[model samples]
Target: MTVRIVTDSTCDLPRELVERYGIIVVPLTVIFGEEALLDGVDIDAEQFYRRLAASKVLPRTSQPSVEQFAAAYRQAFQAGADAVLSIHISSKLSGTLNAARIAAAEVAAEAGRQIELLDSKNVSLGLGAVVLAAAERAVTGADLASVLAVATATIDAVHVVCVVDTLEYLQRGGRIGRARSMLGTLLNVKPLIHVEDGEVAPFDRVRTRARALERLAEFVREHRGASRLFVACAGNDGETEAFIERVRPDLPGTEIIRGHIGPIVGVYTGPNTLGVCPVMPV
Candidate 1:
């Protein structure tokens, strides 16, 4: 049976990779003031960041409606997919996976076919790695179950870490979650952070921004067996180069992809966020 892969925009997969792999992406909405723009579609990374810099208030993110998910699944079926392997960002981070699940159920019942759903427990390139892994399998003519197996394995092996320029964006956007307490105390210090169990948590604190980036590179180097790595920067600070320079020595033979944090994630991560995501083998 032919299989198709579906993921949301939060995966942060590069556009070329998404097109080459034929991965169907349903976007989340980013509400900037009165205008609600589709992530990566109506409002691109450049546009979002520009608006973000100008606006006094932070943008709000909303998950795609159930009907959006259902339509995507229907399209998969229409494309002659005998089965679908749908993956999404962590439910704890957003209600995306829950919407995928409900839509999968609705589509499954009506189509009388199985629509597999997975919770990636990751965001950004961390989630991108899993979707690409599954898509690779599906492209190779693997069945739905086999593709799903690859996805699950990739999720287990992947590790992600990021650095926030300031706590202002996360705090203002109200996505600080567990890092809330750190809000008042160390507002001056740069935060070295990671997403664990799908929510943002502080990994370390450094007196300077450079040190936080050093810690980020060290975190990537210490992962031991990562096969591929992704380095993403959100802001136009030209820090992506600096961050990649520190990370490249350790990443030697590992495949690396560079990304800019898009508008939706940037809403919470704020401007100038840098992240390194690695997917290792089991």
Candidate 2:
């Protein structure tokens, strides 16, 4: 059976990998005042960040509509996929997974094939790692059940931590979750956060950006045994590469993939956000 993988734009998987793996990405909407644009489709990271800095109004994000997801599922089936394994961002973080669930039910009968939906309980590269694992398994001709098993294992093993420039973006975006309490307390410091139990939680606070980056390296050192490491940021100020260099001494001969924080996640984390996603061996 041919099992295809589907994810949302929030996965932050590189475009080449998405194309190479035949992974389908459904986009969410990013709204600015009265105007709305599709994340990763109509707007990209650079443009979104530029507008974010210049515009007086904060941009808002919305989950994809049921019709959009239904169309994606139908297209996958039309392309001869025997079954589709749809992995999405945490349902707790975004309603994207719920929309996918509704879409799956709507299209399953017409496609006459199984459409399995998975809530990754993570976002960005944290979610991307799981999707990549499942896609790799599917490309090896694994059945839907086997691919699902790999995805489940990856979701359980993956860990994500990030340091944002400020907590205001997250607070205004309503994604602060457990990190809400740190709002006023983080005035002069950088906030360290992690995805815990499918929601954002406070990790630590650093006095400087230099120290926060160092702490991110410490996080990788703690998870040195991870099978895969992905480092992502919102800017091109050489921070991602510099971070890898800083951590190279601690983890010799380990492969680290560089990724960019896409528009949707960037919408909340704001610019200059740096994060590390480590997928431990399952």
Candidate 3:
């Protein structure tokens, strides 16, 4: 059976890998003032950041509609995909999964094809790792059940920690969840946060960005045996490179993939956000 992998834009997988693996990415919407642009398509990281700095109003994000997902599923089936493992970001964070689930049910009932939905319970490269892993398995001709197993296992094993320059963007985006308490002294410290069980949680707090970077490297060091490692930045070219260099010693010979936190995730994390994500073995 030909199993295809489908993920939302929040997966944060690189463009090359997306094309190479035939991974389908459904985009979320980012609203800037009166403009509603698709995450990766209509608006890119650079443009979003420029507008964000100049505009007085904070941008808002919206999940994709069911129709959009349904169309994607139809296209996949038409392309001869026997089944689809429609993995997505955390349902707690957005209604994207609900839309996918609703679309899956409709496709199942109407077309009699299989569509299994998996929630990464993660964002950014945390989500990217899982999608890429599942896609690797699928490209090896794994059945839907096997591919779904790999996906869920990756979700359970993956770990992600991010340090945003400020918590205000998160507060404004309303994705703080259990991490809301970090807001009590937002101005006093830099927050070290992790996405746990689909909700943002405080991992630690450091008085300086320097200390935060150290803690991030230590976090990666603690998970050195992961299947892969990824470092993401929100347009901090120098910071991102320096961070990778600092963290590389901990990873030993492991090759860490470099990526950007794109406009979709950047809208909430803001710029200068750097994160470490590890994809551990199931």
Candidate closest to the true structure, highest lDDT: 2
**Candidate lDDT values, in order:** 0.86, 0.91, 0.88
C-alpha TM-scores of all predictions: 0.96, 0.98, 0.97
Best by TM-score: 2
Clashes of each: 0, 0, 0
Residues 53-147 of candidate 2: C-alpha lDDT, one tens digit per residue: 88898899999999999999998999989999999999999999989999999899887899999999999989999999999999999999999
Q: What is the lDDT of residue 40 in candidate 3?
A: 86
Model 3 quality (TM-score): 0.97
Whose lDDT is higher: candidate 2's or candidate 3's? 2
Q: Report the backbone clash tally of model 1.
A: 0
- The Cα RMSD in angstroms, rounded to one decimal, for candidate 2 relative to the true structure is 1.0
- TM for candidate 2 is 0.98
lDDT of 1 by residue, 186-211 (tens): 85798877888888888888988878
Instruction: Give one digit per residue, the lDDT tens place, for model 3 in 195-217.
Output: 99988899999999999998988
Candidate 3 runs further than 4 Å off: none
C-alpha root-mean-square deviation, each candidate: 1.3, 1.0, 1.1
